[model samples]
Target: MGGRGRAYTIVALCLALLAAGVVAGVEWARRWEGSVTLLGNWTGGDEDRFRREVLEPFEREHRIRVVYQGSSAESQVLAADVEAGTPPDVVVMPGPGELAAYAGQGRLEPLDGLFDPDHYDPMWAPEVAGAVHWVPVKADLKSMVWHPGALPEAEVARIARDPGEWCLALESGATSGWPGTDWVEDVLLQQAGWETYQKWATGRLPWTDGAVRKAWTTWGALVGAGDRQRVQRALLANYADPWGGSDPACVKERLEHQASFVRSGAHWMAVRGRYAHAKAVIPGARRDATAWEVAGDLAAMLRDTPGARALIRHLADPGTAQLGFTANRAVPTATYDADPMTGRVDATLRARGTMRCWDASDAMPPAMRDAFHQAALRFLAAPDELPQRLAVLEEMRARHRDAAWLPTVCGNG
Candidate 1:
């Protein structure tokens, strides 16, 4: 071979080797010290707590750098990122309903090999295997009743029988009318039981069904007229803030059915514990009352880098449960017995209990969720317009056939 040819070959080999070394070095650095970006709906104080108690610990233990970005309305931000093709590595949201869109679009990776969900609590009813799209990092039991110690079961019973004693916060900023929806879900459980609850939530049962019509009618009568004027007056008379101020007088006047986190608010006087109180007030408290509720959080994966994997692993670890609670995120699927961190009673409200997982709204698809929220808000504003409101909801559901067609993990076959 000629000298010049030999020299050219050596140079080519050297360049190729250098390029391979650079790629290997970058991958190694990512494994040991690269940064993981995370996004969440928790901003300000909530965000700081998560970093201090959750993210910081993970970084220290794994020796990986973390870039945590938080916002009060992260859903909008997430949509924008997904559109721009620059999403974060990991995301933590309130429920799976929202994440289903991303997963169905092939943006989210299946979490089967990521964690052993069985090791977690069993309150998640659809079961972790069926809910393979997302893993719940935290949860707050809903379907609870709140009232001051001054108010007794008898008082609540009277209020439940009389519409006048009903009080609702029709004014929750941006997410207005959520309180009303809470009432609807609780009432559904009381009137029809879990089987009915699943059917209605998954869109299997029409809104005009006898059971549904009764629920809507009952809610309408609370603020409507005819012979229920006295009841409506009583409900309005006690209408005040459910939270804040020296006392949650509204909760005291009647019964406040809300999520377990209400205990942290200033107005919360007392509860039987997280799950018990919710069960006690619902119909069939003796038969089906439970110390748990269907609950779970949506963990969004923004960027698919190595750093993100570390964050997911750390947060999914059972050891991190306490840290999440301190951050105001209830541990998802927590057994109702005794939470060592918060010292709250954690036990099934019923001797033979069933813990149904998944929030009704979060399980619905995008169009249906928006329609449900809007329809509820309109109905609350004008109780007399219930027929029109129901029509709108039905029409919206019809328009979004895709959402209505989603598979149900647990529902009527």
Candidate 2:
């Protein structure tokens, strides 16, 4: 009697344990079925807005979970992940330049097959579709000027005539030279027009051209007769407090040229607002050609898993546009969307016409971008050595032989 009873009890206990294990495994599998991993640069408030406006809705509707990993050094993290064979399903890089590197390494999934190419603005779709590297998520106008406080019409004319008030931030860290590059592009647009801007941007035009040289001279003069030493000090000092509001360094660069994203906080500090404040800056000041210009923060897919495809779908929709614009995110756009507070300001902005996709530095290759950043620092410090600086840029461009050219959105004509 003792042997039979003990044997039956052991068998029953074993069966119960197996059943429990199977149930636990099933629940775990269910939890991860629609879940996916996303890795990229957004962090803090930006991450929160994305989760609130975009990811939460997406999860609710599709029954998917997004494991978002945010970081400041996203590119480095992405590179390391790829090397370690543990990559994310989707990534929203700052620009197409980095996307090109991933695409070349065969780390990205071609998106043309997954989404409708036409749904995106054609300007953004250019060379990105069939090539299948990246698609634009949202854009901001880069070729814009910001001024703090208020300006009288007479003052606007005065500033335009006197380049001394035209201030620029030379402390953009890994992308420091970009502010300089924006200056060069704006100068070119004012002098040579869009066609020439493209030539210089695409490297079809020589870096040593007279216009290019002139750009250096103009920018160098703006920085005053300082060598890289002085400018570097300023940049380092400026960045020491780059968290926003107002620093004498940034404020002194009075007319900071940057994307629209910084408008609210920066402008709130009364450092600057849009340059086209018709009533404030120039009562009767008319636009040169187009009323507006644009640039974008683009998202690209890293791996081609089904999870990645779902993210692509989420980002491409018009509804997702609000994610980048939420109060928490604070990334601005040049597109005319009416705000009850801003009223007809956006409408007025659109009426003037638009200049399209002219972010010069972002359009260049990654290595060249690094070179461009350092060179701008050098150029600011050594205005007289313009030729030498440009030559260096030319060499850098040559080294990145495969730097892909993205199409211009507004200035093709």
Candidate 3:
């Protein structure tokens, strides 16, 4: 009885201790106020990078569990969640206009105390109704023309004049035609300058105004509006298609008008190419034009719990913004500035006192924004129908005219 009973008692004691430890750990995790859900549009490499560089560190430092959901149809998914009354605690989207709409509806919590206003300018964190609703986490320089190598200014000008030499892809699935919106935005900025561009973007100017009409016609002329084959190819092509390929025809194409994110494409040409400011090659660009079009991924809070607010504060740090390349001047740039190609693009974006405007299509209300994209596609398909298309856009503009527009888009500094 002594030896056998002693061995069994020791084994039972050890098993009881282990079970007690497991119970304690589970209870601690359940009671901790350190769990938040995040919804975003990032996927693939970008999502991996954000998890590694941004979310993981925050989770470790604050002992928070971040449940992330990445989707290409982020807007639709967000809408569904909001309608179902189960929206995530935080969301990072590429469109501020949509955020503004949400904020106006009181769906977003104010970041006024959570984020340092000094870290971001008005354009990056515009306020509405006395509350800062969103902040930029990533930015890209748009309205850029990427070419394999340096081309003379004269050659660039001539290429812009010839429709056959231009390369474009309008396919982005559900967001198909947004690339076209970028072109028109760039042309408006170049030809009409920033002030006029802002007016058109913010609904102050009519879509049929002469300057706006000129921008549309100018884009049409450059992309070969009446040619079915060219338009068809553009319609079928993905935005990243021009970045790389073994096809001689694609390789020989001299110019690609796209955003800075095109640098991430797998295509050999984009990897090896450099970009110039779009104004350099834009026909009818103002001689003194210094405007640049830009876009960014923005972060906003939906549920302002202490853990969620802490996450926003972490993201607001300049160091956090610098973890990725951004157009924000407040973020450090030594890494990007070292490369000549990116440096040039970076310089243009960070230029002191120069006009830097956010992408207009991304700034308008959803209805008008969708109309702008569809209008670009329709106009490209039939240039003759432009007047009718402009009229349709005017109606959309009137419908959404009451929507809030950012007070100022171009920063003085």
Estimate the overall C-alpha local distance difference test score of candidate 2: 0.61
The C-alpha stretches of model 2 lying farther than 4 A from their native spots are 1-30, 160-167, 223-233, 237-248, 251-254, 266-272, 277-288, 291-293, 325-353, 407-413
**lDDT score at residue 237, model 1, on the 0-100 scale:** 34
TM match of model 1 to true structure: 0.74
TM-score of each: 0.74, 0.77, 0.89
Query: Which pairs clash in the backbone of model 3?
Result: 244-267
Residue-level lDDT of model 3, residues 1-413, one tens digit each, is 69999999999999999999999988875564579899998889878989999998887778888999999889899999999999999999996888888988899999878766665556778787569898887778887887666566567767777888788788876778999999999999999999998888878999989999999999998878879988887877777564345542254577788888776565534447677778788778998757888888899999989878988888777667354456556677685866787777767666667678889989887788888889888888899999999999998888887887666666646
Task: Compare candidates 1 and 3 on lDDT and give the better one.
Answer: 3
TM-score, candidate 3, is 0.89
lDDT to native, each model? 0.58, 0.61, 0.81
- Our tally of clashes for model 2 stands at 13
Candidates 2 and 3 compared: the better one by lDDT is: 3
Candidate 2 C-alpha lDDT tens digits along 176-258: 66666666656665555566777776657777788777766765654453645446555564432343554354444455455
